[model samples]
Target chain A: MKAPVAVNGYGTIGKRVAEAIRQMPDLELKGIVKYTPDYSVLVAYRQGIPIYVPKGKEGVFEEVGVKPSGTVDELFGSVSLVVDASPGGKGAQNKRVYVERGLSALFEGGESPDVAEVSFSTLCNYRQALGKKYIRVVSCNTTALLRLICLLDRHIGVRKARAVIVRRASDPKEDKGIVNTVKLDPPSIPSHHAIDVKTVLPDLDIETVALIVPTTLMHVHVVHIQTKRSTSIDEVVETLSSTPRIVVLEGAKIGIDSTSKIVEFARDLGRKRYDIYENVVWRDMIKVNGDELTIVQAVHQEAIVIPENIDAIRAALRLAESAEETMRVTDKVLNVGLQR
Target chain B: MKAPVAVNGYGTIGKRVAEAIRQMPDLELKGIVKYTPDYSVLVAYRQGIPIYVPKGKEGVFEEVGVKPSGTVDELFGSVSLVVDASPGGKGAQNKRVYVERGLSALFEGGESPDVAEVSFSTLCNYRQALGKKYIRVVSCNTTALLRLICLLDRHIGVRKARAVIVRRASDPKEDKGIVNTVKLDPPSIPSHHAIDVKTVLPDLDIETVALIVPTTLMHVHVVHIQTKRSTSIDEVVETLSSTPRIVVLEGAKIGIDSTSKIVEFARDLGRKRYDIYENVVWRDMIKVNGDELTIVQAVHQEAIVIPENIDAIRAALRLAESAEETMRVTDKVLNVGLQR
Candidate 1:
C-alpha cells in the first residue's frame, strides 16, 4: 500500500492537515499550495517541502488552469490524496481537476453541494460516497453538528434535530474590522454551509440559523437536539468520546477562547491534529430535559474542514474500503493523535 | 393618584417605560425628561406635557434651579417618584440641593448600587428587593439571565450556573448600522449581577463571562447550568414559560432583525419583552456531563430595565403586597386600555 498522503491548502485547516500528515509514518510529503505573499507560505517554504503558488488572485484561482509537470503536475498523479484547503467557493473545480487527473481529493465545505458521494471528516459518513468522484467537508457548524447528531442517532433515534448557530464572521483585513457584508437571511443557519449537509443527509430533518460574529478564529454553536429515546448528559459525552474525531472536553482550561489551542494542543501532545474532539461546555449552559438537549460548541472553523476535506478526498477517489469503513479508518487515524 | 410619572432617557428602554407608564391610569401626564439637544427631547416637547431638563445645555425648556424632590434627597419633595432615567453614574440626586430634599426615588441600575433598597425591572431578582429602601434596575444582561435562571431555579433546583454575555455598547445618534466595538476578552456574565442575588441568597453559586458586541440593540446571553433534576426539553420549556417576564421564541422568524424587534413583538402584542423564553440549541454544545443544563437568552437592554425601575419604586415604598403581586396589579392597571 502507498504511504499516507500529503495535503494542500493551508489557510485554516490546510496547515493542520500538513502537520497531521507529518505525524503518520505512512504518509509522504507531496507539496503545499498557498496564495502568494502569505507568512504561512514562507514558514512552509523554509521547511523545504515543495510549495506551489496556485496561479490566480482570490477566486479567479478557479478559472485559471493549473497544469501538471514532472516537477509539479506529474506529482498530482502520484500523490495518494490531495486536500483542498483553499477557501470555500474558490476551490470547487480544482477538486475535480484532481479527480480528472486520477488523484484523490478533498474540498472545504461552503462550496456548492456535490452529488458525487464524498466523505465528511471524523463523523465518517463515507460509505454514502464510497467509490464517488467528489466529496465536501461539512461546514464547521455542520462538522461540529453531525458528529453530535450521529452520536445521538446511535443512542436514541433522532426524530428531528435543530441548531441555532451564533457564528462570528472573520475580520477581513480588507474590511478593516467593519462587517459590512449582508449574509444569509431566513435560512442563515450556517447559511453557506448547511446546504451541503442536506445534499449528504437529505431526509435527516435539519435546519440552521447562522449569525456573523465579529471574531476571526472560531465559530461558537449553540446546539439543541431531539432524540427518539431519552438521553442523559453522561451518555452524550461518552458516545461522543467513543466516536472518531470527536473530543468531549470537560475542563475550564479548555474553552472557546482556547479552541484554536485544541489543534496546537493536539500537536503539542504528539497526536493527529484532526483527532481533537469536543470542548465540554459549562454545565449551566446546557438545558437537557429528556430526549431534547441543548448545548454549545466552539469549533476552530479551519480545523474542522481540514479533516472534512481529507475524508471527502478519500470518497472522491472511491478508495478500496467501503465509505463507512473509510470513515472508520479516518476516525481511527484521528483517534491515534487525540490520545497524544 | 399620582400624575403620570415622567420618564427621562428615552432611547433604548426609556422608550418602553414611557409607553408602559402612559398606559397606567393612576399615572397622569407628566412629560419625559429630554437629554438636551436630541430628537427625543423634541418628541417630548411636542407631546405638550411639562418636560424636565438637567442644569446643563439648552433644552426645549429653560434651565432652572433644580432641587431634588426628596426620595433619597434631603431637599424638598416634588414628584412622588423620580425614575433616574439619567445615565448610570449621576443619579436623581443631581446635587446637594436634591440630596437634602429626601425626595421619593427610583434608580436605573447604572448609579450607586447602594442607593437602591428595592430595584425593579422585567427580569432580575425583584423578589429580593421588594420592600427594601433601594431597588436597582439591573442592566440588560442581568435581565435575560435572571429570567431563565429563575425558571430553572423554580423548576429544577439550580446547583451552579455560569453565563457568557455578549453586549452592545451605548448607541450613537449617527446610526448603529455600521459599528463593531467587540471586546472578546472580559466577557461580562450574569455573575456580577449574581453577586447582588447572592447578597440575598448567600448560597447561590454562579460564574459569568461578559463580552461586548458591536450592536447597540440587544444583549445575547449564553448560559450553562447544573440542575437538581434531569429533565427534557418540554419540561424545560414549560418551566421557562411559567416564569414572569419571559417570552420564548422559536428560531425561524422572518423580518425580525434586532433584539428590539423581539421585544417590540411582545410589547406590541402587550406581552413581556423577554418574549423568547427558550432557543433551540445543539446537543454537542453541552460541555460536561452534569446535573447542569445549557441555554441562551437574548434581551433588549433598554426594555427589560424600564419596568424594573418602576418595580423598584413600588418595592422601595414597601407597598403591602410583594413585587410579584405588584407586577400583576401594575401590569393590569397599565394594560387596561387593551381590555377596554
Candidate 2:
C-alpha cells in the first residue's frame, strides 16, 4: 500500500509538491489544505485532488461549490507524513500541530533552521534527514548552491567558494515585484542564502551576496570556488552534467541566452507549467583557471526545489535507505532527465 | 587660453561630455557634431552651444528650425581635440576624420581598444593616456570595477579577483532594452568585460561574467577578491571610501536598498539628470574572511564614467602631469565628492 501523504497549504510550492506526490507510485496524495475558496482551490478540486480546510472554515469551500475532503486536523491524522507548503513563515506555527498529532512533516526553506532536526538538500544531506520528524528543504538558491558546490567538493575538494545571486523579484504569477529596480534584497552582504547553505553543508566555506532584479523568470548565480586540485573546464562540465537534474547547455551554440529562453525551451518540451526542474547551467560560462573555478547558471525559482521536496518526503518516512536510491526512484518517476 | 574641445556626436555621452567640458575652466566647448536633425539638437541650440551639422545635413537642421553654427569639417578644424561620443561601433569610422583633421581624439569605450594608443581609466592608467593621440576611456562598468579594485589592491595587494556583473539593460533614455529577461550579453563566460579590464590593468588576474537585466537605472556588481594579506572590512571600507569618486553608504542603516533608491537619492541631492557619478558601495555588504574579500556595489552606468571622461580629457590634453593632478582638477571642477 502506498504511503498516504498530506500537502498542507495549496500555494505555489504546495501545488507543485502535490502533483509530484501524485506522480510517485510509492506515495498517495491523501488531501491538500486550503484556507480560502479561491480560484486555485476550485481548479484543484476540478483536477480531482481532495481539498482539506480548517475545521471551522469548511463552509467557505462549500460556498464556492467545493466540498472539503476533510478538515486540516483530519489531514494530519490520516496521513503518515505532511508536507508543510504553506506561505513563508506559516510553517513554523504549523509545526506545533504536526508534533501534537505525532506526524512527520517537511518544512520549506522559509522556516527557521531550528524548526527541523536537519536542513536537507537531496544531493547534499538526504541521508541526514532519514526517519526525522521534520526536514527543512533549503531554499531554491541554497539548494542550487549546495548541488553545485557539493558536487565539485566531492570530486576536487572545494577550499572556499563565493556566489553572487541575481534573484528574480517574484514568481511569474505574483503581482508584487520590483518594477524597473535592482534591489539589494536585505541590502546586506551574505544575504540569507549564504547562511542557509551552511545549514546543509556545514564544513564548506561559502559566502554569497544577492540582488533582486525586476525579472520574474529565474535567478542567475555566478559561483567562484578555489579547489584543492586543478581541473579543466571540460572536465568540470563532464562531471556536473553526468549528475541527474543538472542540465548543462552551451549558451552560444544553442542560442539559449536568457532565463526566459530556458523556460521557453521547457515549454517547447511540453513541460507542465513550463517548469525547468533542473539547474540550467551555461556550459561555456564555466571557466577553470588552474585551482580556481567559476560557473554561471540559472535556477528556475518555482521548480528547483520541487524534486528536493519530493526526496525529503521519502527520507523523512524512511521510504529509501540512501539518497542515491531515493533520487533514482524519484528521478525515474518524474522523468527528471527529459529536458536533457 | 583654455583648451578648445569639440564633442563629436550629440547623443547620450556626447551631450554630457559637452556640458562637462563647458564647466571645466581649463577647457572650452567649441561645438558639437550632429548627424541628423533631431529634438536634441534643438535643445543644444537653445542652451547656446554651437551645433555643427554634416555638410549635406545642414539643410535638414535648417528645415527643423535649428541653425547650424558650422559644418562638421569646420568643427573638427577649429577644436584642438575631439571627444568621439558617437554611437557604439561608429568610433572606428570617425577615427579617419580625426586623423584627416590632424586632431587628437578621445574615444569612448564602445570603440575597439586598437583605435587608441591606450585604454584608459582615470584612476588606473591616466598617466598612460597623457599627451596620447587617441585614448579610449574604458566602459562605465570597467571604470567602476577598476576604481574599487585598484583602491583595494593598492592597499591590501590583490592576488586575484572574480566579478559577476548584473548589468543594466539600457540607459534610462534608451527605449531598446531587454524586457522581462535576464540576458547573458554575450552568452559566454568572461563576457568582454574581463577582456576590457585586461586592456587597462593588463597584469591583474581577474575574471568576469556578466548578465543584462531589465533595469535602466544602474548596473550592480558582486566582486570577490583574494588579497595577499588579511584585512578587516572596516579597513577595506575606509580605504575605498577615501577615494574621490567612491561613495560607501550603509544600505540597511540609511534605508537605501535598491538601484532606484540610489538614483532617487541622487535626485534628492539635486544632481543633474539624477546622475550618481560615484560607485555606490554598500558599506555593510563588504565582507572579509581572512585574505578573501567580497564587495557589492552599484555602478551608475550613465554617470559613473562621466567624471572619468572629464579626467581623460585633461590627461589627453597634457593639462595634467599625473593621474592625481588630473583627478584633482576634474573632481574639484565637477564636484565629484558631492554624492559622498
Candidate 3:
C-alpha cells in the first residue's frame, strides 16, 4: 500500500510539490490545502486533485464557484505525512498541527532550520533526514550552490566558497513589482544564504550576497570556490556532467544564449509550466585558475526544490536506503536531467 | 589638421570603425574599401561615404548599379592611414600594400602580432603604439579582457588570470548559421585568446578557452583572477565603477536581466545599432574570495572594438599625448558608458 501524503499550502512551492507527490509511485497525494479560492485552486480541481481549506475559509471557495472537499485539519487524520509549503513563518505554525496528529512533515525553504530536526539537500544530507519527523528542503539558491559545492567538496575538497546570487524579483503570479534599484540585504556583508547553507553543511566556509533582478524566469549565480587542492577546469566539468539533475548546457550548440532561451527550450521540451528542475550550468563557463574554480549557472526558482522535496519524502518515510537510490528513482520518474 | 583615415573591408568591425572615424574631431573619413558590392556597400553609398574597390573588383560595383570612387590602391595615396578592418588573414596580405605605399595602418585582431610593430589596446598599449607604422588593435574579446585586466593590475596588482570566452557564432549580418551544438575551438586547452592578451601585457600570465554559442548579440566572458595582494570585493567594485568604459550594470535595477534585455535596454536608450561599447559587468556578480576575484561580464562584439579603433587612430597619428587624453576624447564623442 502507498503512503498517503498531503500538501499544506498551494503557493508556488506547494503547487509544484503537490503535483510531484501525485506522480510519485510510492506515495499517494491525498489533497492540497488552500487558504483562499484562486486560479490554482481551480487548477487543482480540474486536475481531479482534491482541495482542502481551513475550516472557516471553506465557504470562501464555494462563493468563488469552486467546492473544496473538506477542512485542512481533517487532512491530518487521513494522511501519514504533510508537506508544509506555506508562507515563511506559517510553516513553523503548521508544525504544531502536524505534531499533534502524529504526522511526519516536510517544510519548504522559507521556514527557519529550527522548525525541522534537519535541513535536507538530497545530494548533501539525504541520509541524515531518514525517519526524521520534520525535514526542511533548502531554498532554490542554496540548492543550486549545494549541488555544485557538494560535488566539488566530495571530489577535490572545497575549502571556501563565495557567491553572488542574481535572483528574480518575483514569480510570474506574484504582483510584486520588479526592483528598480539594486539593493543589498541589510548587514550586507553576508546575506541569509550564508546562514541557511550552514544548516546542511555545518562546517562550510561560505558567504553569499543576493540581488533581486526584474526577471521572472530564473536566478543566475556567479560562484567562486577555493579547493583544498588544485584541480583543472576539465575535471570540474567532468564531475558536474556526471552529477544527476545538473544540466550542463553548451549554450552555443543548444541555441541557449540567455536565461529566456533556456526557459523557451524547457517549454519546447514540454516541461509542465516550463519548469527546469535541474541547475543549468554553462558548460563553457566552468574554469579553474590554479586552486580557485569559477562557475556561472542559473537556477529555476520555482522548480528546483520540487525534486528535493520528493527525495525528502522518501527519506522521511524510510523508503530509500541510500541517497543514490532515492536520487536515481526521482530522476528516472521525473526526467530530471533529460535535455534534448 | 585632420588626418585622412580609410577603413578597409566594411564588415562588422569595419563599418563601425568607419562611422566612428567619421565622427571624430581629429580624423577625416576617406572612402571605405569594398571587395564586393553587397548591401553594406549600398549602406556606405547612401550615407555619402566614398566606396573604393580592389583594382579588378571596381567593375563588380558598377555591375551591381553602384559606382566606385576609385581603386583600393588609390586609397593609400589619398589617405595617410588605413584601418584594415578586413577579414582574418586579409589584414596580413594588406600589410604589404600599406608598406608599398609607405602608408601607416592599424590591423584588426584577426592578424598575428607579427603583422604589426605593436599590438595595441588603447587602455593598455596606447603609448607603445605612438608613431608606429603598423599597429594591430586586438580582437573584441582581447579588448574586453584587457580593459578589466589592466584595471585590476593597476589598482590591485593581478598575478595571473584564467577565462572562458563564450563567443557568438556570427554578427547579425553574417550568413553563418548558429551552431546547433556547443563547439570548442580546436586544441581547446588554450585558445588563441590566451596568446592574444600577451600582445598588450607581455608579462601577465593568462590562459583562456573559447566556445562558440549561437547568438549574434554579444559574447559573455567568465573571468577569474588571482591578485598580487588580497583585495575586497567592495574595493574591486569601486575601482571598476570609476573606470571610464566599463559599465557596471545593477542587474536588479533597470530590469537588465539577460543579454537580450541589455540589448533591449541599449535600443531603448537609442544606442546606434543597439551597440553597448562598454563591458556590461553585473554589479552584484563581482566577488572576492581570499586573493582571488571573479567577474562575469558581457562584451558587445561589434561595438567594443569601435572605441579602441578610435583611440588607436589617435595614437597612430601622434595626436593624443597620453592614454587618458585619448580615452577622454573617445568617451566624450562616442558616449562610451552611458546607459539608460
Best by DockQ: 2
Highest TM-score model number: 2
Candidates' RMSD to native: 9.5, 1.6, 6.1
Q: For model 2, how does the per-residue alpha-carbon lDDT over B1-340 read when each residue is reduced to its tens digit?
A: 9999999988888988898899888999999989888888899999999999878888888998899998988888888999999988899998998898889999998999999999998777787888998999988999899998888888888988888888999888888989888998787777888899999989998888889999899999888888999999889988987877998898889889998999889899888898778899988788898998888889988778888888888888899888888777778877787723
Report the lDDT tens digits of candidate 1 across residue range B1-340. 6543545556655655666666655554355565444555455456553555554433234433222222221112345455556666666454233345454556666665676654344434555665554445766665556656666777778887756565555543435442332333332133366665553345767655454545664566556677887766566666765644554455445444435455455567755443222232222222233464556555655455554555565665555246566566564554411221
TM-score, every prediction: 0.59, 0.97, 0.74
TM-score of candidate 1 versus the correct structure, residues matched by position: 0.59
Put down candidate 3 lDDT per residue, A7-90, tens digits, no spaces.
998888999988888888898999988887888888889999998888888778998877888988787789989999999989
| Each candidate's DockQ | 0.10, 0.86, 0.06
Task: Give model 1's TM-score for chain A to 2 decimal places.
Answer: 0.75
Over all chains combined, what TM-score does candidate 3 have? 0.74
Task: Write out the backbone clash pairs for model 2.
Answer: none
Clashes of 3: 4
Task: Give every collision pair in model 3.
Answer: A252-B213, A253-B180, A253-B181, A253-B182
Candidate 2 chain A worst ten-residue window by lDDT: A331-340
Per-residue lDDT of model 1, residues A227-264, tens digit only: 78787877776666665455555434444333344445
